[model samples]
Target: METVMNRIVSPQAWKDLADRLGVDEACLKAVAEVESSGGGFMRPPSQLPKVLFEGHVFHRQTQGRFDASHPELSYPHWDRSKYSGSVAGEWKRLDAACALDRGAAFASASWGAFQIMGFNFAMCGFDDIEAFVAAHKQSAEAQLAAFSSFIRRPGLLDALRNKDWKGFAAAYNGLGFAKNSYDTKLATAYLRFGGRSP
Candidate 1:
């Protein structure tokens, strides 16, 4: 099935991330399929509080999937209303984030496509949010590298390996939006992508 994600052709980004992380192409592609919906990663350009709030919403959804005691969250909560509200709130902040350009202090702070913190951005050697977005659109490699690092940590891959595209998408996007029969969409996308039966 060819999804908006599968058809995303950020080759430069993919290669940059591959070179840095040494992740296999398939793995990178898979992660990309999850993050950004194969679209250019766009971070909510809001300040720390807003971004943290957004993360909190996503985190809540992520955490709600587990059995409370599960070591790591492997799925999204099934509560449709909860996550839908969260997405609406988050997109508002994201829109605010993007419109920032010498407005409020938090507004100018720079969260890019990957929701990268400014501290991490500095640590990673990026100049600013604009720089990050430009780079992400031009080359997804950095995004891929960062995602590879997040997913490659010991138990993470194991948790993700057993997940189907539906589960995976829920984990990547918030659960509410992800649950709307996305498996069917992914199936169509997979067939279009020439995916074999798993």
Candidate 2:
């Protein structure tokens, strides 16, 4: 028998977040579509939340101690080559990082729908990285709550409200946003959802 994937974000939750953020519902939906459209979890027995562990974060979290001994799990810079590629593969990387340093491991992964990095647990109003991860694993509602808290930072909320795709993508996705075309994709997704940010 296959274990079911847990998905529990409601339509109202999205609407509330959009309204609370002062952006159009379509703006928020476009973000969700671009970030994690397929829902948040790996199917089956493990049922782990979808994550992309950043080796650079692990390196920073651990202060570069594992750089030599475990270069794959910890690196001084963002190196896309270190990724394992699949959800299951990412879990394996997370597990390996956990073995070396649990806190750093959790801090290194980006979790759930918005791909909120675990290091932002405090910003998202979680007491700890584990709590953040637990909430993300529990349901999409929890993920949205984190996203709502996260986007409220200084310029980020305005980026969404004003439909400043490039600004939002840069702030949210890092300086590397353009490399992935995150801005254009967000614009396309927003338009696909019927435009209008306010």
Using all chains and alpha carbons, the TM-scores for the candidates as numbered come to 0.40, 0.92
- Candidate 2: residue 109 Cα off by (Å): 0.7
Tens-digit lDDT string for candidate 1 (102-140): 122122222323334332443444565454444444434
lDDT of each: 0.41, 0.85
Model 2 stretches with alpha carbons more than 4 Å out = 1-6, 44-46
- Lowest-sum lDDT 10-residue window in model 1: 101-110
Candidate 1 has a TM-score of: 0.40
Q: Looking at candidate 1, what is the lDDT of residue 30?
A: 49
How do the residues 1-198 of candidate 2 rate in per-residue lDDT, one tens digit apiece?
222524656778877887777788878878877887736766555667789999999999999999999988888989988999787899899999999999889989989878889999999999998899899888777788988898899789989888899999999988889999999999889988888544
How much does each candidate deviate from the true structure in C-alpha RMSD?
10.8, 2.4
